[model samples]
Target: MCECKALPIRFDYTPKGKVEALGGDLEGYVVAGTKPAAIIMLYDIFGYTEYPQIKQVCDHLSAATGFTVAIPDVFRGKPWSMAKSPAKPEDNLIGWIQSVGSYAKVSSDLKLTVDFLRARGAERFGIAGTCWGASIALTACSQPDGVFEACAGLHPSLFGKDKEFAEALLRPVALVSARGDPLETVQEVVNGKPDLAPKCIWKRMDDVEHGFCAARGDYKNEVVTQRVAEAVQLLAGFFTSNVA
Candidate 1:
């Protein structure tokens, strides 16, 4: 995956879920549910509250699909320090990715989150992520050893390596992308592999910017919110049908 820079984000809405411990040193905001399954919702590098929409989207998914969504604090207590854009040279995004957002580290956290859900009586599992988090989620889905049964990536920032991720997918995938994303790469792969097409859902929100589906989205704009709702519908539909 390539390094991504931070853009503007909005925390215009309040999150409805409560923060709780996910066993050991892990803690995250979990949207309560009555279903027997759970979906692990990973946030972008900005962490949870920096983009309140991350948690809000989890709440929406719970309400829509009745799946208890676990939005883990993958960054723990320390999210990205640069609150505003135009990052200084000292606040390097790649450096943070190599540490807090590294694949080895987040993949371990993903396993822990799945373990916590399994302990909570969740018999089935799915994984979803936005922006940088999507890279991690897709990487896990691509591996046969990964615990998730299905995965979703919203406005994923894969540095144009969608073909690599697509070919390596060991389970179903749902990609809800922005206009700027590399949608055609995966499209071409699935076109050749007819067996893989049914296991995937690719959607593009043409009106929104790169981070529209994640917290970096400005929900203050009516169009962005509407498109986000569409994204939620696509994700909820994918997990409900594929996670079984």
Candidate 2:
């Protein structure tokens, strides 16, 4: 896995429009490359980090696709420890705030992020999110075509919340999951939708659990990684096919 610190590109953008209330500067690292193939990666419930696994996603995806990637910090300067859910109720709220912000906040930030990328030569843009971020990616894709042309949701945790929401998407999507995961069934909704343009759905490695990206640890699945890389390729292909 490569280091997140290794990438040298950076961008600071002020979120505009209705998202201004959730207003905060969006920060992301640009892996410098040519010809404007950009991917905006959404993080898990854990948020963006300097973590090896997170960095590996960016590094491998860039190496495989030759696309400039930028992963934004959505926690607005919070640390990653907030996801630690304790048995006590008081501890839970602190943990929740530390980890997941309000859904509106996340959606707004993402809208701003996509807009910013589009302004900065990201014509072939796609969204990829893991776990909680996968749900966020779904919401962002539901918006009437502006920012993201495609979305890839991995081990998504919130795909079945509202059927109407799933019905609203007008883009291409790819969903990856495992059988033991709680959200495995959720991927079905995204898959079943005929309204979505280009689609790929999989729940391979049936025995794997939630947080497969991290839980699997150093023993990464080359096949699954290749699948993800292929999804990015398809997503970039979708953008080229549709937007270009």
Clashing pairs in 2: none
Worst 10 residues of 2 by lDDT: 9-18
Best by TM-score: 1
For residue 73, model 1's alpha carbon misses the true position, in angstroms, by 0.5
**What lDDT tens digits, residue by residue, belong to model 2 across residues 1-244?**
1211222211221211111222247665445334465676676656544333544556545654555666677876563453453226655644573356555766666667666666666667767777667766766777785567676666665634645545656666666665544333444565676656335444444545555553232224555454444444444444344333
CA deviation > 4 Å runs, candidate 2: 1-24, 80-90, 93-100, 159-165, 182-192, 195-198, 214-244
* Stretches of model 1 off by over 4 angstroms after superposition: 1-12, 82-90
Return the clash pairs for model 1, or none: none
lDDT of 1 at 104: 89
Residue lDDT tens for model 1, 1-244: 1011112323466676889888778899997777788899878777766567887788888777777899888888788754645457787777778888878888777877888888888888889889888888888887867778888889888866888987887787888888887677876776677766787898887889887766577888878887887788778788888774
Kindly give the stretch of ten consecutive residues in candidate 1 with the minimal lDDT sum. 1-10
